[model samples]
Target: MVADTGKTLHADTLKPVNLPEPIAVDEDSAGGPRVVTLGRKLPVAVIDDVWRIDDEWWRARALSRMYYAVILVNGRRLTIFKDLVDGKWYHQTY
Candidate 1:
């Protein structure tokens, strides 16, 4: 038996809070997604495309580019740019 937390829920229904459906991620890490945001428990932007290239080939562990396309709840579009060297993704607002 499950206790009701003042909210009616089915046996199969899970709490929506803190449970975000990850749309996309720049890369996989033991710590989870690098950049994460939720519009309605769903990612407004997901990493649908990825471009990985070994940069500074002469140098060890060079930087790479990772691109992502995100669709916000308000129909707003955004592009996520990430630098693999430092593992950072920036949101591009249009």
Candidate 2:
């Protein structure tokens, strides 16, 4: 048996998780991240991998990004991306 509850649920009530936030990045001459600022400036040690995603071309707002998986000098791994559409940098977890 269940109790009757008079309540409404809306899509807007939900929230997104791990949403990408804008980050400050210093790039090398070849257009790769050389340094990234989270709380402090962290130098990039090596780029582990790189990839690009160009999807939803038919949509008004296409999704285009250049992603980089890098290891910081402090041995911390991070995943970041450059929004090709907006020319901005963001850090996210895969």
Candidate 3:
């Protein structure tokens, strides 16, 4: 058993992790990502995979996005998504 020390003890608060951030991306005529800009523009060397997610239609803000797993010309790999709702791009970890 622990004794009270006359000071309030608060539990650790929870916080969100890995929230998505907007990024700049250039797409091809076919609407596929051709370049991604982090600090500099990096051409996509290879597009390994692609998928889409559309959920929470009943909510005020629905989630709709097209995801891509790509390798850059500099040999770095990244997961990126295009928000179908806003037509914006973001990079995220898998």
Candidate 4:
């Protein structure tokens, strides 16, 4: 079962807490990341949903990401994203 985390998007909730973690991702044949390793090499138990956002594309610091709301093998739900612009992964919490 998915955990019931309340959805509250405050202004301070989206701070740039970029730690720049290096993750090992297993991608599909089409080049889509299917599995990701956070701290324990957890497989994606459930992909609750996914979405993409393309912002500030004209600027140098463009933000393009494919965000996934996935449940890990350890049963922790997390909001992670892949930076389409630079091909990096980040784990975010609010």
Candidate lDDT (C-alpha), each: 0.52, 0.95, 0.93, 0.78
- Locate the minimum summed-lDDT window of 10 residues in model 4: 16-25
Residues 1-94, model 1: lDDT tens digits = 9987797778678654532122434344642334445433343444445555566867776757555565655555656656566765555444
Per-model TM-score versus the true fold: 0.40, 0.87, 0.84, 0.67
For candidate 3, write residues 46-94 as lDDT tens digits: 9999999999999999999999999999999999999999999998964
* Span of 10 residues, lowest total lDDT, candidate 3: 8-17
lDDT of 1: 0.52
The TM-score obtained by model 4 is: 0.67
**Evaluation by lDDT, superior candidate among 1 and 4:** 4
Model 3: how far is 89 from its true place, Å? 0.3
Distance from true location, Cα of 60 in model 3, Å: 1.6
Give the clash total for candidate 2.
0
Highest lDDT scorer: 2
CA error at residue 10 for candidate 1, angstroms: 68
Q: Which model, 1 or 3, shows the larger TM-score? A: 3
For model 2 the local lDDT of residue 34 reads 98
Off by over 4 Å in 1: 1-42, 45-48, 59-61, 92-94
